[model samples]
Target: MHIGIVGAGLIGVATARELSRRGHRVILVDPEPLSGATHAAAGMLAPVAEVTYDQDDLYPLMATSARMYPDFLAGIEADAAYRTTETLVIAADAADREFLATLAEFQRRMDMECEVITTRAARALEPNLGTAIAGAVRIPGDHQVDPRRLGSALLAQVLQSGGEVRRTRVKAIEEENGPILRLAEGEDLRVDHVLVANGLNAAELVDLPIRAVHGDVIRMMMPAHRDHLITSTVRAMVQGRPVYLVPRADGSLVLGATSREDDLTGVSAEGVFQLLRDAHRILPSVWECEITELTARARPASGDDVPIIDRVADHISVAAGFSRHGILLAPIGAQLAADVVLGEGGNGPLAQSVRLGRFNHSPLEHSTRK
Candidate 1:
């Protein structure tokens, strides 16, 4: 099958990689390089720490994606020869500790395992964690991939596998005999199947309920023991605010993020300040750290806060609405879409729950609630 993916973000790259591997010709369409959420993401493949209320259906997909990452990263690392890192979720307050305990309980309900530890034990594991921390959990299975590295690797893998990547933005898509992609340069590229994975811009081509949720982040160089600063991901909820510090393989630590739904235009000074403040509270010595980089991007979110991975028209598929789960769910979403493109006509319950048209029926909406 010939598949045309209309985005170069993580979803598009993953889809291209998967489709190309499955003996399909995939043409990747996007003007910007693979540098959206994939570049800015912290790349924590964690489902237990990212859960919310009334999102049971999402857990299965997230769990499936989490289970898929080891093999996915192993394949990518073998192809790209990059280091794969582990991830951990931590708590800085008693309330957050309790919340995480409840969260771990919820995960166990889904037949997942997470190890609990005391604040002192957490600091012992990662000595840089501030003394104010209450407790932590070691989810050794949750891994971290450098999104930039992963995107570049996947782009290389896709191209090497005979997939054609066009550096052109898709203006619109129309279904005529098959799906026709209107490029930004006014060139119409037709293909057997089209997948919309353009993040927030998904609303432009189709009336998707997707919106951009703005997030601002900052990065800094790890000062002392830079190489061993953090062996795993450290996340903390300090003073009721969610802030995480992800230490990369190169001694660069990413501190993030702030969620703003009302404003999607750009980064807010207040948002950066809040993130820094929260980060400092978790690691008081961070104030002495040198600033390296600052990033701000919007993640595509939907009413249900999960991703949509279903067919729109006959050959047109919409794969946006990742909210904040794009990186964690990309592998499975791409493979499932490829299956759909190959004429396999079935979506699992979770995928059906996230389909674009699910909102139209409105029959009790168990998927939305569960």
Candidate 2:
């Protein structure tokens, strides 16, 4: 089977890699691969730490994906950027500690590993943690990866396996006889199935109610003397907001994330200040690092904040709106998406959770097609 996939972000590339390796031809289309959220993501595989309130369906998917990471990375030979570093979620004050304690309780009840440790224990583990920190929680299962390197590796492997990647935009997918992909500059390519996984942009091609939520990420290089200054990813809740510092194996730290649903498109100065300011409350040594990169990108989210996976048309399956869990859910999401595109039977709980019928989505209204 020849598959046409739109959007070359983590999800698209992962699905393309999965299908192509299984002897299916793949043509992935994107104007700028990884220019979306994947380009700016600090890949944190933290199913336990990222569990939010009332999102019951999400934790299962995340946990399943986290377990699948090892085998998946080994399959692609992209383990260089993968790390098993533990995560320490810190709290700045008494109120912050209480908030984390409540969250940890929920995590524990869900059969996930979350150990609440004192501030002293946290400082003993990292040694460089801020002295004034109130408390911390340890999650050994949480890990980190370099998104840029991992994405490049996935794309390279797909190419190595004889998949084709077209650096052009896909205008639309029309099904005259089968699925016809209308490309830029008046070109049309037909395919057996088309999968759309291009973040929020998937809305334009299909009736997915995906909206853009922007986040800013900053990269810094630790001082030469402080190599491996922090081995564990440190996430904290300062002033009721969340910020994280993810350390790479290369002695660099990624400080991020201010969630903004505003119309601002560029990197928010306030967001940067919040990350740096809030991060300092947990790891004061961040002041000594040199600022390297500051980036802002829009992550996709749906009305329910779950991924959309269903065949919206006869030969087109849509998989988008992963929100911040794009990298974390790639392993499982890619395989499910490939099955939907290939017409393979799948009625598992994970599949039912993300079906398009949950949203009551209106099917493709394009009358010119079919």
State which candidate has the highest lDDT: 2
Query: Which portions of model 2 miss their true places by more than 4 Å?
Result: 75-77, 366-370
What is the per-residue lDDT of model 2 for residues 174-232, given as tens digits with 9 covering 90 to 100? 87789888998779989998998888878667767888999999999988887677999
List TM-scores for all candidates, in order.
0.91, 0.97
Candidate 1's error at 89, in angstroms?
Answer: 3.5
What lDDT does the true structure give each of the candidates? Answer: 0.76, 0.89
Specify the poorest-scoring 10-residue window by lDDT in model 1.
361-370
Q: Write the per-residue lDDT of candidate 1 for residues 1-370, one digit (tens) a residue.
A: 8899888898888888888877889998888866687767877777777776698768878888877876776656432423345455667678888888888887777767677877777777778777777778777666666778878888889988999989988877776687788888888998998887888877677667777888887878877654546767778777578888887767778888688876546668898899888888777867877887888888888878878777666777768888888888987888777766675746568657776665663212221111
lDDT of 1 at 279: 84
Off by over 4 Å in 1: 77-88, 224-227, 361-370
